[model samples]
Target: DQQVKQNSPSLSVQEGRISILNCDYTNSMFDYFLWYKKYPAEGPTFLISISSIKDKNEDGRFTVFLNKSAKHLSLHIVPSQPGDSAVYFCAAGEMNRDDKIIFGKGTRLHILP
Candidate 1:
């Protein structure tokens, strides 16, 4: 199965605090992992990514960690801002014949003022 699961559907965080989102996959062939953030009524935008061989990847306030053996990955946001309040999706994929991505259901993040 190509299911990517985000067990938590939502999270609430205070501004300037850290937010963590967790994901799990059952497919071992997935070599590339991605995190996407979405605002209301908008398509998700890519936030960060990591290859299966890498344990960690970071971009400014965002960090992504992957553990292939555990089939697990997480996204962390430090000092999360109000703008960061949105749905986060985790995706796992191998290069398709046409090279596209498959995404998870997503977790909504709510930043408290």
Candidate 2:
């Protein structure tokens, strides 16, 4: 079974608004979580991350929140811009798994101008 899951295939948001992406995981061993943004014809780039010890992490307009007890996580982008449109992947890694990470299918976000 896929440990990480992004139930929403896509989402849309207006420019200068907020964008929220959700993710779920079945594996409790995951100690680290990350969000990556991908563009067409290019590889995914790391965005933000949070350790199990922390519930929230933020960088500028991007923020990530993790709920270990619920095995859920989310990414929030404030004042979304058109350039923020892309496919975002939620990834998780277990500390003892040799640093191998598991990624969700991905959720495509569209920013409307």
Over 4 Å off in model 1, which ranges?
Answer: 95-97
Residue-level lDDT of model 1, residues 1-102, one tens digit each, is: 547999999999999999999999998888999999999999889899998878999999999999888999999999899999999999989954357777
- Residue 96, model 2: lDDT of 61
lDDT, candidates in the order shown: 0.92, 0.96
TM-score of each: 0.93, 0.97
Q: How accurate is candidate 1 locally (lDDT)?
A: 0.92
TM-score of candidate 1 against the unseen true structure: 0.93
Q: Name the 10 consecutive residues with the lowest summed lDDT in model 2.
A: 93-102
User: Residue by residue across 1-113, what tens digits does model 2's lDDT show?
Assistant: 99999999999999999999999999988999999999999999999999999999999999999999999999999989999999999999976668589999999999999
